[model samples]
Target: MASETDAPVDGVLIGEEATPIDLTEQAEVADASFAQVSQVQTVINHIHGDIGGASFGISGSRTKSRRTSGPVSGHEMAEARTRYERHESYEAAAQQLGRCNMVALIGTAGTGRRTAALNLLHDFVGGRREVVVELSPAYTLEKLATREYRKAHGYLLCDWPKDDVDGSIADFHLREIRRRVRDAGAYLVITATATSLPAGDQILWQPPPARDVLLAYQVAPEIAAEAAAHITPEHAMADVVALARDLAAGAPLDQALGRLESAGRRDVVAWFDAPRSRGELFEMAAMAFTAGLPEASFESLLARLESIAGIGMEKADAVSADDPMPSRRLLRVAEGSLFSLSPGRRLEFKVASHRTHVMRELYQRHGMRLWEPVIEWLHECAALRDNPSAQAEVARGVAILASVSDYSYVDSTFLTPWARGNGVMRSQATAAMAVSWLCLDETTRSEVLRTVSSWTRASAARPKFTATLAWSGELGIRFPLEAVRMLWLQIRNSEKPVRHAEIALARLFAALTEATGNALPMLDWVARQISNDKRIGRAIDPLIRAILSVLSARADGVGIPTVTAHLRTRPDSAVPLAKLWSAVLVKRPHRRDALAALYDAVCAFDERDDDDRDHVRALFAALVEALPAKERPLLAHDLRRYAISRNTDENRLEILLSLLRVFLSPAVLSLDTIGKHP
Candidate 1:
């Protein structure tokens, strides 16, 4: 394996800016059969977080009070004050509130009705902070009508229920609410769907163009304009805001928009649910699964689908009767040139978002009647050794299916069968990739983690190995601490530690250190593990090897080792680094590797004109202090012998010997001897 420094940092992981490990390369190194699963690597590279850039959910410094019932928190209000974009109806609504002391803002869902209401109340109260109290959505017209209000304060009621027993919205109720607000010298804004209320008191609201909302969030104008091109009247303000936030965070426009459209629209469901020929439905399924593959691959998969679904005869009969051209039939469901002269022509849906929707509806609503055949087809595709790309695309489709369908059902039907036993490496790779995908969505992430964690304890090596591969890829990148902890569990529980588990631990640490440019957290974790056990037990050999691997790994075209660079960036990490190094030196098997890595770091620091030398000296001092007095002389002798073998200049060798001497002085030795006696 290439050193960490020589490893090229690939694309970013979803919701995180981390270097993704090339699992295919790593897998091949362990088992040559894994070379055929290269498509797994490609799938990992293309996976992005869902819209909103939150793998878990949108997180910020804003307080939790934003979601609670009370006066809106000052922090939340300040945020809204900057990002709120007023609709055309906002001014008219504002004027009504100013004159009547209350106004009802009505609009279709996702039109920013609630936002307009909040803004109106904020302006009506003259922008006084925390004066805007958000009333519960459960408040009925009767309660609101008789409710007393605070003078000079603003009240906002969002999405007030229409089915309240107080009866449908009436003119008398509006008049009473208005009277109450005016008498109290307060303002109230009620946001609701279009209702049979008096027009004089209600303003039908329409949100501004999606671009304006994006701009309000400080999104780049070009990106916002491009995103706005795809926005339709049906796209909700909330989804658009999420899109803007994602675009601002440097997410690709197409991927973000695809997730937005897939989540926001149900057109795909309607299309699938509508009456359609069995042949056509099968064609759609084939297209959904093999959309990006070449035309020949599509035809092969489609034929397999038709055959499995018992629609081949039906498809032939329909073609004989209607004689519709293949392109025309394909045009009905998908959008690609079937007759393109190019040999590499690919077939895909007109709307890329529909592919996921198609698979989701087919697997969920259609159930096993469709899923059994689809699973069989996916497995066949996974077994295609001649077309690794097709196999990869199959894995991608399976991941999407797993994400959309009932997870347990997918697990039973597909993941379990492919992941356990002597299943082909390609199939196991697909299962592992699917688990990684499940980890990307907030709804499924925890469940996926729990399931994979359980798999680590399975008696079968393949399942455990699959779980290890899942963590070594995107799962580890997104949740490094959890990934590390769970991997340790797998390692400690094994009767004999799996080599793959050891390699995965190393990759996880290397990728994390490369991405963060700081190894302190990982180094600190190693220190804690060592200190808690108070012995360099064989159980922690994997952890020790991982630390050494990181220390020796180098980036491409960079001379400094990963650890040296980390020390230069954060000199304080030397303390923890030394502690881990001390453990490595005493581990016997890793002693030589640890010393060699330390010598390289010392040499790199010696060449620099900065304070990095002090870090090296501190590291050496801590390393010596952490060792037993009986081991210090042995460590010194090892360093001298290792330096002589390397044939380095005397200055570098003298630097190491001198630090060892200072920390192992007669006074320190006597104190260590006394402590051991005590």
Candidate 2:
């Protein structure tokens, strides 16, 4: 039923001829990618039991139900009340909240601002029948005005959107919300950064002494004082709390603090050494790879993990029942789970730092005992086209594993197979995303670049395709010039040209031009490539088509095309423009579109400023000069005919015609042309 290329190679399916996926705008892609990385870091901070950070999400109607209905869990409220240490501004903030029925807590991150909000609410509702509900960060004054509030309840809303914190908030909107709270006999406390609020509305809160925080957690006074000595101002309250727990458990002061400094390495070691059943181990391994994925996706991955471990569902069920700890308790103890910003709940480790450690430990201690099966499972995950976000997370997990484990082993086991084996665009995307993430760390960037460079030269189509995706997406966006060079190498050296690579080059050039508002760097690169006699011969058609695509690309709100804007600012771009146009006109496929683009750019230059005429003249002269002597007259004739057909102005037409004649003169036409000059 399937072609040879579509069949499985080893465990991975080969899809070298797979169609490329459509790329979204670079800004959107960058935001999603950055959020993925940020979420990973947030999970890692959870290793220290930090609660200050929340999952990333944009406010939308889909999240409105979750935002409004969920109350702050009782455990969270109890923990906050027990551990909260009053800051210098606590009394002032409490007084404000009691008086106005609302107070905004403002401070930098990791300063216990959220905890302070919870505690303030707790004290306000003391001896009263009330619940503390955390309103969504997306909550607004309008919602406050409209929604019915339960009498005597305390509300906490952390990290309110900054855009909503404008001058109106200090005036009418704040007054209105205050009126609503007072009328309902309820108290509200909103936490935000100082920058997000008006100076008058900000009740500045600073973290209290670390010793005070440790003592509040019921640590021995002597140990608390001693541990506080090691705590820097930059240390979050969460980290201090974690340290206190260790001290209460009889850990040495130095070793307890050392664990905090060591990114949960000691904890990870302890976790593996004390682990229980096969099911729990498999679940941890699955979570290590699938954190931040939806619950259904996570369950799917868990099933796959069991299959890879040679544990049948029937056996797994028996093992689960036989285990002393319940599945729910095990989930809490082994892997910390949380709901993602997306609609469904997602799973994540309680201590995200343990994720990297788990991955590295499995590879080191288990070796092929786990790596081979994990690799095969990843290929199966990559083949699933329905859940791209899940696929991307899998790739990110691998990149994290690669960061801590043997780079060569991880590369060979996962990236190389996915890149060379699957023609699936999603699989290639997985490889590309992994490569991009690896490139983020300076320590691994060189090796990643070197490996990807070699892939561009690979004889297999899938490898080249994967490399093209990397160069076009995050890699190209971050390193435009180098991306251009590598992409050019792929295009030139291939026995036959790759259309996707050419399109990627055009897209890269267009994105850079739009972002920087200057196309000189890209234009310069194109000029150099076009100037090369041998290289240009091998890649002439794709090069010309790519140039045409870049010229035709439009930026939002810009009246002129990309090329017109470039020539207007940097007249020197005309040389490259000429060389590119000369090649385009000589190629039959792109000739008509090239002529239209040239005429449009010329007309645009004329309409804007008379000073642009010199650049236009130079562009025409060089374009004609770069063509064969026999073709120069024909190109000049075509240009004149096209301009007149578009009803060119008589004076401008005369100038263009005169310039064309001079450019087409025998001496000028005798100048060297690109390659063999057709």
Candidate 3:
């Protein structure tokens, strides 16, 4: 045994005793090629396909097994692909490694050097030499590095220090054979790429070993011609050179090369036969190669071939929902089939929660489609949320279903009845469902306007109060003249003050009048209710004051005179003082001609009442003595209209009319003298 520090020179005639590192390091050693960790990762990626059944278990003991697949013959699908080698400039430095001493690949790593070394090993060290020993960085301790060389010799053959591993391979978790190889002084390797290795026992990649090992896998000329002639479909030729290169990788020989050539394959020659991006680039080539393999070939030749970066085969399930609406439709339209690769992933809407992670793994490792199968599931899951029973995402679900701002159509046609309708779900389910529809999107607002027109035409004879509120507040309409018209009518027709009337008033006045306009009905209702419910009459005063304020604002020499003549016939039933103060007193601030008439009427009524036993009889006498014969009919009509409008008796009307006739027929008497007549 000898240390690299004290090694004897060899090329030591072909079969002479090679230096044994095991004695120096007190560890068992074996033989293996030297390569870097990145190269190892590249090869491992290809071999890792269809591997779910091979789960890692708590291992005290285990048996080894190997699987193989056939290869496409060089003649069958060949191409005269130019063989290329990684430049020594890009190579990571190599060194003797392990306590037992094996050829160790060492370097302050550049780029493709490690992987270039791994690729060479794939061609030369075709058998068990394929296995790689991945070592964890924590095993820097000498005691840990050589711990498992003897146990691992049968299964593993190379050692790659995650970060400068030496000494005990065991401490670094080296595969047994890798440990032995390092201890045996013949295997050297590097491990610095992947955070973890799937299987350590496989040839990953390396620089060409012996010339025999570096055999260029070229196709026959005709095959290359044929393959080259067979151009990829024009539409599939996005990044055309990439496709041509893939075609070359798949064709058996130059026989196909002519075909590829005839197909104008050289048009995309830039992507042919070179290693650029290890993960995706390699996977695409592998997939294409695997697809083109001949049925008759032995799979053993292709077994443990390097993996396309992070790819594999798995069982795809029937579509699962991501949302509630049109889930099936979305699935129907996808171009590719769902492929299950990783577990606990697309298990749900389980989309790539992190784009950096998914995108990096995919692009960095070869366009990994880990979320594709589940991506559609995401689309479908999005649809199902609309089905209130499936999930509780009402806002999202409704957003999906709505073609407009209002869901009134859904309510009228489907949802509202469904809320009260018999079904597996109700209450919250119904609420969610209704809410789903209730929520309006940009388009739904237009739909609401259209529906309102239809509603209006249908309700031409009826009122449209409900529809109005539905449009305004609920739908976020700021200016709706149509809505306002409906509100104004509802207030006038209502039996008493309704709660929505205030909401209607506030919204309408704010919109149309800038908070200045109000209907007279509110003032009338408040006054009547207050006077009737005397206990809270004082509470009504402020509102009355506000009404007065608005009325005065409306009275500035306007056309058609907003002042009502309707109250003139039935003044007792009207708020005369309120109206007068609001209109004339507040606005004019000066004497009014109309005030003299009111004062004269008041004086006449007082003089006639005198406490006479026949109060009505004396008032009639006073009224008749004061009037002229020509006005009798007009006075009678006024009294009649007043009583009827107030819903009072005809008897009161007759008494006033009769008193007016006392001074009729040119027999009028003085007002003071007429009091004795009763």
Per-candidate TM-scores read: 0.57, 0.49, 0.20
The per-residue C-alpha lDDT of model 2 at residue 319 equals: 68
Better of 2 and 3 by lDDT: 2
* Top TM-score prediction, candidate number: 1
Tens-digit lDDT string for candidate 1 (367-389): 56776787678777765656766
Q: Model 1 segments beyond 4 Å from truth?
A: 1-238, 242-284, 290-352, 364-369, 382-392, 424-426, 515-522, 534-572, 597-618, 629-633, 647-678
Model 2 clash pairs? Answer: 15-423, 336-350
Please list the Cα RMSD from the true structure of every candidate, rounded to 1 decimal place: 15.0, 22.1, 41.0
What would the TM-score be for candidate 3 when compared with the true structure? 0.20
Q: Give the Å shift of residue 218 in candidate 3.
A: 3.7
Q: With candidate 1 superimposed using the best TM-score fit, by how many Å does residue 19's alpha carbon deviate from the native? A: 39
Q: Which ten residues in a row have the lowest lDDT in candidate 2?
A: 57-66
Q: Which segments of model 3 are wrong by more than 4 Å?
A: 1-186, 194-215, 221-678
- Give the per-residue lDDT digits (tens) of candidate 3, residues 1-678: 112233233221346554411111211110000011112212222223333111111011001111101121232111111343443422322211223233333322222233433333333223243243323222333534455543222111112233334435433554553445555433433333221322322223333322211222333344434433443322111112322344446743443334321233232132333344443333222222122222212121122222211223321253357534554324422333111223422211111111112222233333234333322222232233223222223222332333222244344533323222221222213222223123222223333443443332322211122333332232212223334444444444443343333343333222222111222333354334334543223333333333333232212223211223222222222343333332222222221322232222222232234432133333333444333445445544544454455553455445444454543432443334433553
Give residue 534's error in model 1 in angstroms.
5.1
User: In model 1, what lDDT does residue 142 have?
Assistant: 71
